[model samples]
Target chain A: MLGRGEIAIVGAAETTQLGAIPGMSQIMLHADAALNAMADAGLKPSDIDGVACVGPMMPQQIAHYLGITPKWVDGTGVGGCSFMLHVRHAAAAIHAGYANTILITHGESGKSRINATPRPPEPESLNGQFEAPFGPFGPPTLFPIPVLRYMKTHGVTHEDLATVAVVQREWAGKNPRAMFRDPITVDDVLNSRMIAYPFRILQCCLVTDGGGALILTKSDRAKDFPTRPVYILGTGESVETNMVSQMADFTSSRAFRVAGPTAIEAAGIDRKDVDHLMIYDAFAHLPLYGLEDLGFCKPGEAAGFIREGNTRPGGKLPLNTNGGGLSYTHTGMYGMFALQESVRQMRGTAPAQVPGAKISVCHGVGGMFSASGTIVFSNERP
Target chain B: MLAPGRAKPKPTPETKHFWDGCKQGKLLLQRCGDTGKAYFPPRPFSPYTGTRNVSVFEASGRATLHSYVIHHRPVPGFTPPYAIAVVELEEGPRMMTNIVECEQTPEALQLDMRLEIAFTPMDEEITLPLFRPAKGGR
Candidate 1:
């Protein structure tokens, strides 16, 4: 458990601009995020002894770009959730006295890049033989199939899924870093151009080219730093299957069901103690399914919960305070944003801060809900 | 030249029986001879008991519509405006298949709706097992 260690988030930073930045390479974006995060923690580049990254990005590439060599390096590619999982790894590494300060980073340029040639998957890559043959090539299409299944099982309408987009857009209106700040109505969501059925343009997240980074160190060490430290209370990770087609339940994610309990147990807290939530919302329906699988709501009741405004601002539980991937920026790796939002909430720095947020839960699902990572954060460490 | 429909999925020696059953409009699942536990994406060996003597058995195509969504996007082979559903078979296996011969609307899809297998021939070597609302389109 991360709580057994002394790790805490001392700094966080995200690229100021999301969406199309024509000139910058992915490495530049990563370096920019790293520099800003170090500056936010009031630490120099030499202070970081560890580096971790998620997805297809390379850790050595980022290290070279930053002009620093980390003693410990990990390039865990567990899809979008890899960064949250890295927090746990960092905690263990720090407790083992391997590294005192660690930097977890992510960067991607999904949009504004046209491939003259399609990059082939590695011969041994899990996706190479299993999924590429099927038509669910991208994350957007892969998730919609399950979203449709959820809608059918729960009697959730397209408008119900749109409600998620509408609420996030409302939250984005307050966030200057959000990619789309304009207010949108549920009708607008329904009327938006359809990418996949039941999923309109609004329901899908934007393909913004950006980066985010976080700095983690011992809680005692963070006291010397300028910013308040958000202690990592617990962390859990689980994977059901590598391929989407092999999963037993398409609508219900096994990863969340398995990882959520472990996280809550590791945190030594009950579900009622969580004050805010930062669930990965690669698509609007993901968080809804996540909430159900995490036991926040009963099966087939997430749509009703969202319809009653339980997840909006001033609701019982405010979610995605940074506006989430739907309205914010989804750099393919959405776990970075979830952790960033949780840290902001714990430190009382969120644009839409929940009052007296003592404990917060951040969750991320990687690769079509096949893998899940959950972490619980607290303002005070035991 | 490429054909206009779903390409035939080549079944290896392990999966040939499963695809053959689908062509016959029979849902076939592999059950371990030792444990009698059914599994899907048919394997030559049983995962439960690690038994090599896995037996292929005809499964009751009757199932409940566990969940579904209507997709407007067209894939390489599937047409636009198709409904993909996750059906929980009577034998406790779940699989993804398309729903046909029913209006693709939320009101039309009810949870736990009873469905029966409907096979559609895609090409010479491929036959997909789809589902439609049972009897009265329920």
Candidate 2:
């Protein structure tokens, strides 16, 4: 798989301000993060030969805007996890001599709706024909469709789901940049207003305005960068179904089952080697599913594993130390923020850094468990 | 006004029969002639084999609740709260539908409850095949 650690992330940074960036348009958020990442590595846009971003035809838009003439470009917008796929594709392209330095950027004016184009329902499309007639407002309604089935089959209680958010907020409480830093209890989560059945408002991710960017290059030249290189040990990306209703299984993610193992195997590491982790918490139920699907716990055991204080700070596995999408700022597509946390943890620069954490596994979800991408990072040169 | 302001499905060449069947009070599913697998949201070819040799047939319109969410937000035509459900058809294909003539509450809407299709015409151009509690079943 292109040899482990062949590609290294030399530069990584988010926009100057994250929470409410009404001042920046969607495209400008991308540019702001790109410029910051470039400055972090002591490089200019002229040094980058490859560019990638979310959505179709966006690579050309971002590359041209940054005044870069890229030889390799990728616009693999599967969903929120599209940035994870971009990192995987960029690494392969750099190794294949397609480009020297590759840049991946993510920006969404989710809260401000600045120059944001809301997708109109297509009556002629498959979703419009079958699923849309039932009245799903968006991710809040659509993503939770399978949770009742999951809870029934797994014997998971509502309190188990609330624990996922409660623990992540514990991590968020340590970060000054987190959107919600106050300590929250499981009762507090349950008492919050219900947006959907079995899911309180605290369980859902925040819609914020932010962006993040990353710069990847060959590990052989990693020493030349100003920032410490976070080596890309392995990456895997896969999609199960575009329609959430068509998912093969409601309790487990097929995409997560495929991507997580593929990445861990590609890195040739066991579960114990991963000291820190970031599972995209678009909702509280996601972390429960991710933990099981990624082989951290057996089927139906993740809820209890999380409830037992295993993933909290000073626990065996510190997960979502940046508060994750639950407490951290989620700008629609949260994969970039997850990757940024992983890079920070590996470099020992995270706001709530895991002590001596060498390997960090970052797993992300797109849409309603529609797609998944798992990336394994290590500070140690493999 | 039958379901005013609701987004209606625009049938494509391959999916026309399914919509047409709903108008005539029938639930049609596409089955691959080569593999004998019945599928939903009709497509021309089999998803398993990619063969266009497929046939359309009337389904029994019987399904069991696979999963659902009670959305509490107001949408275009739906009320403040409604059950958006996915039902596992007896033929093995699952589809997203709504449960009608029932209270939209967890106490009332039980998982794995038997359901039967009740086609409601949204407009002259489209008819939605919704489901309700099956008669003479659990």
- Score candidate 2 by TM-score against the native: 0.99
In order, candidate lDDTs are 0.78, 0.91
Q: Which digits, one per residue and each the tens of the lDDT, describe model 2 over residues A276-317?
A: 999999999998888899999999999988888899999899
Scored by Cα lDDT, where does model 1 land? 0.78
TM-scores (chain A) of the candidates: 0.94, 0.99
TM-score of 1: 0.86
Worst 10-residue stretch by lDDT in candidate 1 chain A? A114-123
Q: Using TM-score as the measure, which candidate wins?
A: 2
RMSD of each: 3.6, 1.1
Candidate 2 regions with alpha-carbon error over 4 angstroms: none
lDDT tens string, model 1, A204-266?
988878888999998888788888888988888988876665676766888998877778788
| Top of the candidates by lDDT | 2
Query: Model 1's CAPRI class?
Result: acceptable
